[model samples]
Target: MRIKAAVLHASPIAKPYAETRPLRIETIELDPPGADEVLVKIAAAGLCHSDLSVINGDRPRQIPMVLGHEASAVVVETGAGVTDLVPGDHVVMSFLPTCGHCLPCAEGRAQLCAPGAAANGAGLLLSGAQRLHCDDGTDAYHHCGVSAFAEYAVISRRSMVKIDRDFPLVEAALFGCAVMTGVGTIVNTCGVRPGQSVAVVGLGGVGLSSVLGAVAAGAERVIALDLSRAKLDLALSLGATDAFLASDPDVVEAVRAATSGGVDHAVEMAGSAPAFELAYKITRRGGTTATAGLANPNARISLAPVHLVGEERVIRGSYMGSCVPARDIPRYIALNQRGRLPVEKLLSGTGPLDEINAAFDLLDQGKVVRHVITF
Candidate 1:
């Protein structure tokens, strides 16, 4: 089948992506789903910073790859040995395809599945197959086994989680990444309890989702920080007790002073050394500093081991919010349905795939939160 998809031929592309047009919208060949795979028609795909990271070469992947990992889709067909799902089922794609027998999967840590990680790094499906090809017979790589920025995709069954048919697909796209990472970091990784003070650095879709997670978890103080005042205001409206500009030199002091020393937990979602450092500095003694941001591979943070020993500080890395998608996606969706998550507020707007470059420009400029490219 031929599908309209976005293909990146090279990376480290210069900015003003609207003009550079890094992602070429081309009609490409999509193969049928193989065993343990399914064909899905994409309904919505979100423009995330992680995708931006690839565009700017922060997180490089194989060239000639179709780059989209967060999306919601409808099952069009199921391949051999796939019995759990059927055609017409609404589902959300998980960036990592978890093989149930893997060590991490057996340990209930699907986010760390070894096979999934290897497959993602190699730009292949869990089945070790390449399903996308170009007109010139060039093979295109899958982005985290999803490659969702297209009209349709053939994905491993392990890469999708079935959702209620009625859940809005546009909103469902967020659960795949932003909601899972943001809310999962607080609820699953940090286990933030009621009345605890929490600070979240960065105010993108994921960071703001953390704000919602903190408030929903009953955090007495949900502090939000970012370079954009607009995002700060948005966070404040989403139940954050205080909002501060991350660029403020005294931001750490202000947060510490307001929280009566510091917050119990501080999460870095900005994917930068400076943001991680800020999160670490705002953590109270004996507190936890967690980072879920996927920073540049070369990015490094400076930390004092003395603080870890003397202050008893705990620093942890969170991937996919340390969530098991099969269990957590529905749990988070339930929260959304109950009106507690209110993830709808995060939608900046929607656009067609033809305007994808412009949409990316909006995301790169910090002008939008979660912009969905509707198919």
Candidate 2:
């Protein structure tokens, strides 16, 4: 099948992406779904920071790739051996394709599924097949097994979670990555309980989701931090109890003074070394500092060993918010439906696929939270 998709032939493209136009919207060939796979019509896809990292060369991936992962789709066809889902079923694409039998999957840690990691790194379907081909006849790589920037995609069943048809599918795209990672990191990884104090460093789509998660978890104080004052104000409007300028030289001191030492759980979602440092510094004694940010592979942060030993501080890495997609996506969606999560407030706006480059520019400038490309 032939479809239009935003394909990145090269990375580290000069900024003002509207000018360099890193992603070329081109017609590409898509193969039929193989056994254990499903063909999906993309309903909506979100432009996430992770995708921006790839465009700016911060996060490297195989090039000439269809660059989208956070998406909601409707099943158009099911491949052999796929019985649980049928055509017309709405679904969310999980970036990691969890094989139920993998060690991590068996242990209820599907986010760390070994096969899923290998597949994503190799840019192949979980079954180890390539389904995309560029105009030049060279095979293109899948982005995190989703390649969702296109109108249609052939994905492993493992990469999809069926959703109720009644829900607004456009809003559902967020659950795939931003909502899952941001909200999951707080509720699942940080385990914020009622009356706990939480501070979220970074107010992108994911970070703002953390704010909503903290409020939903019943945190006594939800602190939001970001370099952008607009984002800070938005976070405040979304139930955050406090807001701070991350660039403020005395920001850490201010946070500590406000919380009487620091927050119970500090989450780093900015995907920067400095953000992690701030999150760590603002954690109360014996508190946890968690990071779900996908920082550049080469990026590193400095930490004091004494703090970990003396204060019993915990530093944990949260991938996909340490969530099991099959279990957590639906749970989070339920919360959104009931107005407990209120994730819909995070939507910056939506546009057509042709304006994707402009959308990326908006995201790069921190002018929007989560912009969806509607099909």
Candidate 3:
């Protein structure tokens, strides 16, 4: 089918030490799915930070790629052996999918399935081929295997998770990545218990979702921190027990005081070294500090072994919220339906597909919690 998509191809090579910008928004064609794949009519796609990472060169991706990963759509066609989904079913696209038999999947760590690495890199099916193309017959690879930036996408059955028909597809799209990562960090990784004290740095879409997740897990106090008061306000609306500006020198002290010496859990979602440092320093002895953000390649964090060893504090990284989409996406939707996860408040902007670049601008300025492209 002919589809209008934002295609990024290689530009004239940059000088040895300089950066090269990828070609943007060349319309392309998308082929129907092959066996074990499904063609989707995308209704809405969320502009995730990961997408911005590729556009700005933070994430090195292949050329001639369609850059979008967080998305929700209606199944338009199902390929052979795809029995559970059919036309009209609403679904969310997961950038990471498990083959069930892979080492990670068989070990209950589907998030790290071996195929996931290749899927994220080439955005292709397990067979190592793309289904998108240019009118001139040049193949356009998928970005993260589910390039929802286009009006239509062909994805693997393993990557598509069916959601309630009545769920808001646009909001559900956010769960495909941001919410999954944020909420899953607490619920799955930390197993936060009632009355536990928690602090989340970065109040963006993921941070706020962490706040909501902490609250849902019955944390007695959920502290939200960020440089933007706007985001802090939104965090409060989403159930943050307190909010603080990252610029405040006393931020860590204040958080420590609030949690009575230190918080039970500290989460950093800002992808900044300083934020990770703050998260680590504010956790009490034996407390857990989780890094859910995708940090830059050059970014680094330092720690004193003596202090780290003495404290017994656990510091770890979480990828894609440690989620298995087929199991977690629907559970998130159920939480939203039950009014436990207020996803609607996280949405700050929505517009047409043509405004794709504008959406990226808003994300760069930190002006929106989440932006969606609606058909």
Candidate 4:
């Protein structure tokens, strides 16, 4: 079948993407689902910083790719031997596909499944086949095994989680990446208790989502830090107890003093080395600073060796919030339904697929939280 998708020809493109317009919307051919895959019609997809990373060259990918990993879709067809889902089932696309037999998957950490990573690195399905062919007869890679920027996609069953049929697809799209990474980092990776003081650095979609997670987790105080005032203000409206400007020279000190020492937990979501540095410096002794940011692989942070031993400070890296999609997605959604995690508040607005370039511009300026592309 033929469908429309935002296709990025190559990664590491020249900056000022607005002028270059790297992601070109094109109509292409998408094959049917394989035996281990499912065909989905996308309803909404979120514009995440990770996707921006690829466009700006911060993250590298096999190019000529359909560039979206966070999205919600309805099952249009299921491949042979598939029993868990049928047509019309609403689902969120998980960027990582779990090959249940892999070491990470067997250990209940499907996000790190080796086979999934391999598949993602190669821009192919778990079976190592490319399903999309461009008009020029070139193979288009699947971004992170999802490639959900397209109107339709064929994904491994491992890449999808069936959701309540009535759940709004726009909101469910966030759960695919931003919500899972941010909220899961606080709830699952850190095990934040009700009285713990927490700080979330950066105010992108993932960072703001962490703000909601901390509030819902009953934190004594939630300090929102960002370089943007607009985001801080939005965070305040969404239950943040305090807000700080990351650009302030005294920001780290302010966070520490406000918490009477330092926050028990600090989350770095800005995907920058500087943001991670701030998160680390503001953590109280014996506290944990969890980093979920996908910084450029070459970027490095300065960590004092003595602090690790003397202060017993835990500087842990959180990938996919150490989540088991089959378990955490439903749990988070239940909380959202109960009004404890109103992630919808993070939606800045929606745009059409053709306007994705403009949406990326807004996102690059730190002007929007979650920009949804409504199909």
Q: What is the per-residue lDDT of model 1 for residues 1-375, given as tens digits with 9 covering 90 to 100?
A: 999999999898987888999999999999999999999999999999989999899998898999999999999999999999999999999999999998899999999999999999999999999999999999999999999999999999999999999999999999999999999999999999999999999999999999999999999999999999999999999999999999999998999999989999999999999999999999999999999998999999999999999999999899999999999999999999999999999999999888898899999899999999999
TM-score-better candidate, 2 vs 4: 2
Summed backbone clashes in each candidate are 0, 0, 1, 0
lDDT values for all models? 0.95, 0.95, 0.84, 0.91
Give the worst 10-residue stretch by lDDT in candidate 3: 12-21
Model 2, residue pairs in steric clash = none
Q: What's model 3's TM-score? A: 0.95
Candidate 4, residues 1-375, lDDT tens digits: the string is 999999999777765677778899899999999898999999999999989999988888887999899999999999987899999999998888989998889988888999999999899988798999999999999998899888999999999899999889999999999999999999989999999999999989899889999999999899999999988999999899999999999997888888988999999999999999999999999999999999999999888999989999998888888899989999999999999999999998998998898889889888889999999
lDDT by residue (179-212, candidate 3, tens digit) is 9999999988888999998899987788888998
In model 3, which regions exceed 4 Å deviation?
10-23
Return whichever of 3 and 4 wins on TM-score: 4
List runs of model 4 lying over 4 Å from the truth: none
Go through the candidates in order and give the C-alpha RMSD of each one to the true structure: 0.6, 0.6, 3.1, 1.0
Candidate 4: give its CA RMSD in angstroms: 1.0
- Tens-digit lDDT string for candidate 2 (78-191): 999999998999999999999999889999999999999999999999999999999899999999999999999999999999999999988999999999999999999989
